[model samples]
Target: MPDKKLQLDIRIIKFQDLIGRKPDKPFGYYGLGVQYMLSGKPNMADKLFTQALNIKPGYMPAILGKLEVLLAEKKLVSAARLYQKNRDLFSGKKIYKTRVQRITGSLYSGKFFYYYLKSIRSVFVFNETIGALQRMFNADRGNPVVNLLLAMFFLKEHKENERAFILYNLCVNMEGVPDKLRWDLVKVLAKDNPDILIDEKTAALFTTIPEGAVGEPYANFILKQFILLKDTDKINQAFAEFQKNHSFPDPKTMWQYIEFCRENDIWDSTVFACCQKLIDYGWIDRTIAETIVGLKNRKIIEYTRGMDKILSLYGYI
Candidate 1:
C-alpha cells in the first residue's frame, strides 16, 4: 500500500499541477486564480478568475475568487452580489452549510469593521463607531471572531480576566488559526491568570520546535511575547527556543519590551538584561534610569502612605 502521508502530498501536488495545463480547464483556472490572488498578483489573479467563470458560469470558487479581488479593489456592491451568488449555488451539503454559517458569522463580525471604517470618515462620529462595535459584540455571542475581537476590546478597556477567559477557550477550540495567533492568546491568558495552572505537556507544544522543524514567524513572536509573561522556568525554556530560531532583538523593540515589563510590574533579570543593552547603546540615559526607579519607589511610598492614613483614622497609627 502507498504511504498515506506521501499519497496525500502527491494528491495536493497533482491538484497544484492541474491549474495551468493547456486549453485551461475550469478547475485548473480556478485553482491558479486563487493562488495568484493570495500571492498579491491581482491583475493575473483577475484574468484567471474571469477565465474560470467564462469556462463554467456559476462556478462557486470562480465567483468567490473574483469577489475577493473585487473587495480588495473596493467594489463592495459587486463583491456582495458575488458573495450571495456563492451562497445560492450551494446544494445543502454539510460543507456548504458550514461555509454559509461561517460567512454569515463573519458578516456579523464585519459590522465592527464597518463602524471602525466609518470612524476614519469623520472625527465627530468616532464615539458612535465604538458604540456600534460594543453593541454588535454584545448581540453576537457564538461567533469566535467576535469573541476574540471583544477580548481585544476588553484589553483596551482594562477588563483583564474577561479578555483572558474568552481567549483561553478560543485557543482550545479554534481551527484554521495561525500558530502565531494561538501563541498570543496564551500570552494574554498567562498574564491574567498567573496562578491558574495549565497542562505542562500541552504548554510544552509552544516552547520548542520539534527536531528538524521550522516555525511560522508569528509563532516565534507569540512564544517570545509569552515568554515575556511566564514564570522563570517557562520563561527560560521559551527563551532558549526563541534564541535558537530568531535573531537578536532590535534596540528599539527591546526598550519597548522593557517599558511594557515596567508598566505591568513584570520586571526580572531578562528585563534588566534588555535594559542594560539599551544603556550600552546610549538609548537610555542615567536620568531616565533614575526616573524609572523613582516611579516604582513612588508607587510603593504612596501605598504605604495610604495604609498609614487608614491606620490613623482607625486609632492604630
Candidate 2:
C-alpha cells in the first residue's frame, strides 16, 4: 500500500469520483470538503462546504466544517462575527455558547486573546490583556478557555511558572475538552523540559486528548505525553485516530513518533510501519530525521537499538 499521504490522495480522488457519480448527496461533498480542509485548501473546502449546504440545508457537519474553514482563513478575527451570526445555531453547545458570549464578545482589536492565540504576538498592551483574561476567569472559572488563556498569558510572560502550571493542570483535567485547547505555547515550553507541563507519574491519570482535530499540534502533544508515560497503547490509539481522520499526523508528528519510540525503548509494528513512511514530505524529509537525531539524548538501550533497527529496516540507515 502507498503511505498515508498517498492513501489520502487516493481517497481524495475516490471522494471526488463519488461526488461526480452522485452530485445530489451531501455526504460525498462534506467528506471531500473535510479532505480539502485537512490538505490546507480552505478556499476549496469552504466552496465544497457551501455546496454541501446547498444540497442539504442545515447540515450540522457542513455547518461545523464551514466554520472550521472560516476560523482557519480568518483565524480569530471572524470568530466573533461567525458566532454572532450563528448564535442560535450554537446556542445548544454550552461551552462554545458561553465562549462566544464571554471572550469573543469582548475581543480587543479584532482578536480574542483567549480564542485567537496567534494575536498574542501583536499584543503590546500587556496589562489590558491580563485584566481582560483575569476578568474572564473570574466570571466563569469552569470555562477551560478562560483558564487556558490565563495559562497562556503566564506561559507567554514566562514570569509566573508556578501559576502557569496551576492553570495548565486545570485545562488538562477539566470536565471535558470544551474548547479546543491549543497547546502551541505549552509545546514550546515542553520542548526543553517535557516534564514541565506533564510528567510520567501523572500522565496516566490525566484526561485523554479530546477527539476533534487531526494533524494538529495539540494532538501531537497529547500523543507525546503518552509516549513520555511509555504507554504504547494510548500512543497507538492516538495515531489510530489520526489514521481514521484519513489525514493522520503531520510529518513533524511522524518524526516525533520515531524519536519517542527511541526515547521510550519500545518498538512495535506501529514503529515499523511509521519507519516505512519516512519519505519526503516537501517541507520535511522524514527519512533523515535529518538523520538518527543527536547522540546525547538517547534514553534507553532498547530505544537506541530499536531506532537503528527501524531506520535500517526501512533502508534509512
Best by TM-score: 2
Checking candidate 1 for backbone clashes, the offending pairs are none
Q: For model 2, what is the error of residue 299's alpha carbon versus the real structure, in angstroms, after optimal superposition?
A: 29
Show where candidate 1 strays beyond 4 Å.
Answer: 1-25, 42-136, 148-168, 171-173, 194-197, 200-317
Q: List runs of model 2 lying over 4 Å from the truth.
A: 54-58, 70-74, 80-150, 159-169, 175-202, 205-232, 235-317
lDDT of 1 by residue, 175-280 (tens): 4333343444455566665532243333443434322223434334434455455444544554455467654355654565556556566645566556556655
Candidate 2 — what's its lDDT?
0.58
Global lDDT of each model?
A: 0.51, 0.58
What clash count does candidate 1 reach? Answer: 0
Give one clash count per candidate, in the order shown. Answer: 0, 1
Instruction: Summarize candidate 2's per-residue lDDT along 1-317 as a digit string, tens digits.
Output: 68878877987999999999999999899999988877889999889889999999877667767666755654432433354456566666665544433332222223344544455565564555566656656655654435644664565456446656656666543332332343333454465556745443333432455456455555666666676676777777777777677755656667777777666665555554454455434332443442344331342122546556555566545
